[model samples]
Target: MKYKAERDCKTYLDTGRLFAPSSKSCHVGLNQVGSLPLEVRSWTCSNCKIKHDRNVNSAIIIGDEGLGLLALGTSTYCP
Candidate 1:
């Protein structure tokens, strides 16, 4: 997106951190990789106690962070 959008897009260290079932409720965090699939079918937040569609939630996170990076002029990718 950084290259194609011609705008600053960042790969947040926390991008992949969203998928850990353990951190399902914790939301954002530092970089960490887990033994999870590339696309989870569904999930529920432990803390919030609410169900969520995996893809939708991920898009929200990625989009929010990407916009943040654009504001900072620090484009990046999901790694």
Candidate 2:
């Protein structure tokens, strides 16, 4: 038997831009430089100056990317 495993979007640009937890109000994505360490659970966006939860932000990014891929007709399964 053969099996295939699905994966979540895990690629973060080395520029760290992907790590940016965008500000909901301004919709700005900024590199989370020096942030998101193991102990850090949240951060404030420099653009909009809004605080964001790290986990929640990460989830949002992953979801968005997954949706984007779907919209592109790249994947039929929802990641």
Candidate 3:
């Protein structure tokens, strides 16, 4: 017998845009940071054991609280 496990995954564009049918040019948390190296796709937080995508982690940092001061254009200021 053959068996396979299915996992849910979503792909984002190189520009950090979500691959949703209705997605716009909004800057998601993943886009602000950049792409993840092929080898370091996932990492565990030093303090927390939380597993995070390298790309997504960086984006979160870029969009962290108090980051509004560094806003560049509409991409950063978009509500």
Return whichever of 2 and 3 wins on TM-score.
Answer: 2
Q: After TM-score superposition, what is the CA distance of residue 11 in candidate 3 from its true location, in Å?
A: 27
Of candidate 1, the 10-residue stretch with the lowest lDDT total is 23-32
| Global lDDT of each candidate | 0.51, 0.52, 0.37
Q: How far is each candidate from the true structure, as Cα RMSD in Å?
A: 7.7, 7.7, 14.5
Candidate 1 residues 1-79, lDDT tens each?
A: 4364434443433446554443222235422334446565665554465565656665666666657767887754543
What is the lDDT ranking, best to worst? 2, 1, 3
Candidate ordering by TM-score (highest first): 2, 1, 3
Stretches > 4 Å off in candidate 1? 1-40, 75-79
Residue pairs clashing, model 1 = 9-75, 9-76, 10-76
lDDT (10s digit) by residue, model 2, range 38-74: 6867677776677777667766665676676667666
TM-score of each: 0.47, 0.55, 0.35
lDDT by residue (13-78, candidate 3, tens digit) is: 132334221111113322222333457566554344566765565565445422443343223221
Q: How much lDDT does candidate 3 score?
A: 0.37
Give me the runs in candidate 2 sitting further than 4 Å from their true place: 1-30, 77-79
